[model samples]
Target chain A: MSTAKDTAGEDMPWDEVTPEAARKLLVAAVEAFAEQGYHATTTRDIAGRAGMSPAALYIHYKTKEELLHRISRIGHEKALEVLSGAAGIEGTPSERLAEAVSSFVRWHAGRHNTARVVQYELDALSDEHRTEIVELRRRSDAVVREILREGVESGEFDVPDVPGTTLAVLSLCIDVARWFNTQGRRTPDEVGALYADLVLRMVTAQK
Target chain B: MSTAKDTAGEDMPWDEVTPEAARKLLVAAVEAFAEQGYHATTTRDIAGRAGMSPAALYIHYKTKEELLHRISRIGHEKALEVLSGAAGIEGTPSERLAEAVSSFVRWHAGRHNTARVVQYELDALSDEHRTEIVELRRRSDAVVREILREGVESGEFDVPDVPGTTLAVLSLCIDVARWFNTQGRRTPDEVGALYADLVLRMVTAQK
Candidate 1:
């Protein structure tokens, strides 16, 4: 679940995306969309990035929106997988929440280019696709909320509002993708550690 | 400093911008940029929205990029003013920090359409324009950092990483523009209050 190493290696986080050409198209589309945004990036530009012809792009995906939908779906699935992995880890709620936040932050920082497009370009997706993506986001919300709820029930966390705090926590972690820079002082691991510590501080029992 | 009422009435946050036609163009640009993104919004579209001819747009602003630069500059100034106002309030570090986050969050949520364009369309700015906006952003950061630094010095807050926490706090407030909806369950004031509480919890001294 650690995406830290993927930032510097050929072992990309998109390994699960099958059919090499389709994955290539998807990867190219992510770059195009990130750089030029969805409305300005043409299908031709995505095809050119993939070293394929526009005809070839059509062979795989019908429209640019489809490429974005695929990226959004796949990205959300990976995000959910990472959160669920940490949530199920054997530990106290504090430990679990820390793990959840650190791993989640790691993904957002390390894969920021792709994460930016996945998280920000939702308005460009077709309504049907967006509905599906929204459901996945709700699941992500549920995962974090459950952790806070468990901590509160166990008297380990002093959250006044579980749902509201959950949104704040998730929003804090998610915004990392918007500002994370490779040339910045902190590495992904450092940010993940700092954020996890801060998040734990947010929920720790006040005493 | 309270922007909570701006979401519902005629008193707009963009009143600082002038003349009436230029202000109309800026307002139109914000709407167009928010709905279709920076790269996709045409000069003609902006002029049309302002009920002006495309040639009239060129008369007021040399190019579309210039229009964006003006919006960004104004928006950043407003954000800095909001942060500075909260920072100067006579209170403890905790009170100042809470006010800063709550007011900052309110602006993002209340004036979200402009905030959305201001915060998200940054990459589309010319390098010089972006640099100017980035400098304004640094000032905003300094205000938050000073609050946290004072809190640490006063032993009222237990922040180990002032800069990192400042980034998280600002990022959390700024992202309200990304997801804030008028039709949503929580009003701008409610979100601002909730975020302020959560942020205080993040920095409050641990037992």
Candidate 2:
């Protein structure tokens, strides 16, 4: 970790990576994995995309799985930040939940190329890495579940099942990565807005 | 189609593949594709799994892509049947919508391996085949959207965005294939019931 700072500024701590070159390689890996699934993509392909020799890829990522780990870790962190940011905002539960869904969905749609690789390729991770990533996902789920619990408690929402709805909401947002296309009629913002209103209807008390 | 019945008694169209040998190859392909992915799973591996020679495999399916197409086609046809059946049921729009989600989610959870390969591996299909599957998917979406429209007209629901909610609802159910595991705490029935209620909440006037 110190070596990274000794050579380059300490912007982040991944698998002890975040250098500009490492970051470029990681982005290339994400594109390769997204375009042609994790198992199908080769290290040679990733290195080739980044315009780096195959040997240079190993200087940063020990293996292709490591590259996937870094991408998934970063993606989950962004997802958590988006959800928790909305959940922590100063607003009613309905407002906050809408904010959470809209922003989270927006990220999934806008960064769908990376999100697709991160969200869909969990099975490709090593057992230990997958466990760690699952922990991150569990926490992400908790963020939304807590919002639903509060909504139910405040009598602001009529949710019959908090955990169930939480799963549905997260599933709903994650799926935008699977289907959203840049050329499609709905832009990320439109989808985000549409989901926010639909989610509000899912929870808010009837007038 | 008649060839199927001439050789083997036609009990069912898709879920029931004709002859024992053909069924084994399809099941083997589903497992291989799910485990290693469509792009990585070789025809030899699929044939090996089915305990057949590679030459024998071609008699039933022309290529690995054809196997994927068959699995995807049958899976989607079944999905359409479930949604259309639920929509055609005698009930309120809310009841029908709930039934549709419940059954769809149940299939995704119970047959998660096949569902995972089918729903997630669309990009691997040939363009002509994918277009056909997309048509099936479009019809499936229309089933749900039609129900939502009926709910709005009947004043049974208060959705501000019918088309948007339809997309969210399908996305919510399809994602069950991604996260659900039979060995996990929840059973297919449990998930189906939970989604049914949550979906009702999404559409119906909040009570």
Candidate 3:
């Protein structure tokens, strides 16, 4: 539920970096950040989880903030790519939008620990880093907005406020990280499929 | 936008805490908890925000956890009351559900800083306290579930899974706290109205 799962059935196209030690540190950092939150997590905790001395963390990442920046940048970049990938696939607007939501929701629910840290810990980033991340976030929004626009234009969906509905869809997906429990009855795929169907209902209003 | 204001257009039924000092401390705590999160925020920091000594905080509700408990309890209790109030009203199922979503979303948007802490920072509480708080949360879910069940039973709504739709509806409303910004375009009332319409579409599937 937390780390290192195959992207089968889900559309998580994240990469594992080279230099096994650094990847270990990054993975450890994600767990720490998810469990204790960004502000409360310490460099020592990350280092200890990675089986290294405190000073060892500085060799790869200068500060705890840098670790967060790296994780966020990569996470958001991959998330944007996932959205765009689904959006660009050959299909009707509804099909593409459903694909996007299914995969996007799956990523958030399946890899929710990393997603939780990525989504909620933006404030801990310095301004420069945050601006970069926010730009990625905006692009992610544009992907969804463009799909909604296409749906409306094609008469497949009847969204009155495309931008507002875009935000609502993304909000609904992002919140899976906050509330999705592995112990719960539904699997990530089940939740993702349900959300995809529900989102289509949101746009088309099928009774 | 973050603090006190008239609930004229917005249907926020929350009452401001009585006793000026307690209110001040609660407001300060909400700001601190919202900014730094519960684990990173200390009692001293919360007291300082209220312009009180560290010891002065003890005169008001004991430890930092107590402050969070008080805030969370009151907020959830009010939220439950809001939902049940709207549900208990004499109206069609759609009307009552819309009223519930509108007022509940309004409360979350208008008082989002407090809501952000109450919704997102639950893991910071002690085990005993969290158990108590979780019961309130279940009650909140029950209110919405009951309404959805009524809607489904009446053949007014087309939801296949009442429990799943209930979770989605609540998730949509709860996450307004995470994303709603005062500097953004819509007011709380507007957002509430929009969400009410959307929730109606979600249930009724009316274009």
Candidate 4:
């Protein structure tokens, strides 16, 4: 197996560095964290999973905590990125809401392991780190809430409690990771489309 | 500093044990498992929290896995028990469903720690143990699905997808343990009532 030191010779410059290396590292970290949880996962495990030595792993990230923090941040950021893009598309409130839900389900399905780490491992971080990740989570939640709030305000949805509805929608999407797996019957796209329909029905006003 | 032997000297029979003792042990196990995860928690840790030693702990349960299994089995049984009881009451499908949701929320709120362990720790079990627990979970889920299916058949609920709606409802309720702490602003009763209302609205046909 190539050691982390072996990869050091091929390290690209900052601007030229592809996310391929970091992405592979993050993917391995997510599987380790999800399987063994945050506190149990060692840097060596992540390094081994990524097919690199511990020293080579350190070339990409400083500590096990740092690796967790980076994966969580990236997962949150990617989710926000997708939601923000969804929010920009022009459509009726119901239509836009459906699109946003679809985006969330798709993102979650594609990155279920990373999503699990982001959702469950926040407590393993230090106070400052936990706060930072919580804020990121809040922002992602707020994006979904904003879309639902807009739907409710526009009379397209009739939620009795805005906060509860927001939580319901987000929870439905988030919990998909707990059960969704390749071993299951439905493909990610199928689940995503079905979820989008269900969510839309959940929030939309009865005709 | 008392051992489990000292603790079980009291005349609390297994069948007639006080809810207080069971609750105490369950709470201690929850905190230990939550902090250390299931694999890392020793019987001593749970006994330590319950102010007893391992021998006393074993009086109520044969093994650590048995304790964990009972905690989960009891939680699921209580929820199913509530649902079964609620189903016998005379009401519209919507009303009964709301009552079922209320019962679920109350059960989870009252036993949040046990709920957390039951929801999150199955993966740590041996394959045979995990399968048994999974079956229990599926049976519990089926009770909810039966209620929803009855509603659909009676034309009292307007959910688009029966299985998907069942999942959404269960997901919303189960995720409460992830964030519902006693320190939060809302009381458990208040949260339960609010969630019950949300579920009713989500599934009920408009007047």
Best by TM-score: 1
Worst 10 residues of 3 chain B by lDDT: B6-15
Q: How many pairs in model 3 have backbone atoms within 3 A of each other, for residues 3 or more apart or on separate chains, i.e. clashes?
A: 0
lDDT of 3 by residue, A134-188 (tens): 9999999999999999988888889999888999899988998888887788888
True contacts kept of each: 0.80, 0.87, 0.48, 0.30
Structural similarity to truth (TM-score) of each candidate: 0.94, 0.90, 0.91, 0.83
Ordered list by lDDT, greatest first: 1, 2, 3, 4
Instruction: List candidate 4 stretches off by more than 4 Å.
Output: A1-23, B1-26, B47-64
Which run of 10 residues does model 4 chain A get worst, by summed lDDT? A5-14
Q: Taking the tens digit of each residue's C-alpha lDDT, what string does model 4 give over A1-207?
A: 222211212111122224667656766787788777777678888889989888888888888888777777767777788887887699987787777778887777666776777887887777878788889878877887888889888889877777777776777778777766656666667777877777776677877
Highest lDDT scorer: 1
CA lDDT, candidate 3, residue A191:
88
Specify the highest-DockQ model's number.
1
Candidate 3 lDDT over B18-70, as tens digits, reads 56777778778878888877877888898999899998888876888888988
Candidate 2 or 4, higher TM-score? 2
* Stretches > 4 Å off in candidate 3: A1-15, A205-207, B1-19, B205-207
Tell me how each candidate scores on DockQ against the true complex.
Answer: 0.79, 0.64, 0.57, 0.37
Off by over 4 Å in 1: A1-11, B1-11
Residue-level lDDT of model 2, residues A1-207, one tens digit each, is 323321112122334346878977887787788777899889999999989999999998889999999899988988898889988999989889999999999988877877888888898999999999999999999999998889889999988878878888888899998888777889888999998887887788776
In the range B1-207, model 4's lDDT, one tens digit per residue, is: 112211212111123235666656765776777776776678888999999878878777677787777666666666677667765578878777877777777666655666677787777766787787778778767877888888988988877777777877777778776666666667667777877777776777766
Question: Which rank order by TM-score, best down to worst?
Answer: 1, 3, 2, 4
